[model samples]
Target: LLSDGRAQGYVLNDDIFVFLGRGKIAGLPVMVWILILTAVAVHILLKYTDIGRNLYAIGGNDTAARLAGININKYLIAVYALIGTVA
Candidate 1:
């Protein structure tokens, strides 16, 4: 709407509210839904991907993973840094 300039003619309020059962859709509920979906997506990726498996292995046994030719501690720090960035 804003890109098309329709929004420029209107004065929009910046308040957020949560509505019950059959009320209007508001900003707060929409923001909550977006956060919840993002969390779920990250959880799924961490639990199911090959990188996630390697990460868990590194967490469980750094020395063994190093022997297996994995850069154990470096990747661990990388993963932590990535999570920090996302947060």
Candidate 2:
């Protein structure tokens, strides 16, 4: 998106603490929607995707997954790189 200049206004300008404290539920403030959406998406992906299965297999045992033709190292590195970028 950035490469094509499509993310120009897709920026989070608010402070984290303000967003956290200002977010609300019924009669109380909280940041639950983000967590709930994340949980649902993870559940759906893990239960219904091959990539999720491959990830679980790699996590269980890299050597066994490799013997079964799973590219454990590539997935691990990709996951790490994603985390690095997000951080």
Candidate 3:
């Protein structure tokens, strides 16, 4: 759709459509690799990083997270942007 949702919709190029729909690595589909890679990366980030701790803290209590030196607004904005991009 257009920016204001005034148009019908968007379309992907045929080459790109076929490339992603049919491309494989070693016998696995491209999407499978993408999913696995994203899952692993997110798991590592959320389970083993200070940013993850701050994010959790923010989720629990914004005031406490802020007092603890976690920039709640930054993380909240970043999370929303990431989600919007993915969606």
TM-scores, all models, native as reference? 0.55, 0.61, 0.70
Model 1 misplaced regions, further than 4 Å = 1-28
Model 2: ten consecutive residues of lowest lDDT: 5-14
lDDT of 1: 0.70
Clashes of each: 0, 0, 0
Model 2 lDDT per residue over 1-87, tens place = 556965455356677767776867775557576667667877887789997899899889889999999988788898789557644
Best by lDDT: 3
lDDT against the true structure, each candidate: 0.70, 0.77, 0.83
Please tell me which predicted candidate would have the highest TM-score against the true structure: 3
Clashing pairs in 3: none
Which stretches in model 2 have alpha-carbon errors above 4 Å?
1-21, 25-30, 82-87
Q: Tell me the lDDT of candidate 2.
A: 0.77
Ranking by lDDT: 3, 2, 1
What is candidate 1's CA lDDT for residue 67?
87
The 10 consecutive residues of candidate 3 with the worst lDDT sum are 1-10
- Which digits, one per residue and each the tens of the lDDT, describe model 3 over residues 1-87? 346756565566688777778889889998889889888987888889987888889889899989988878889899889768756
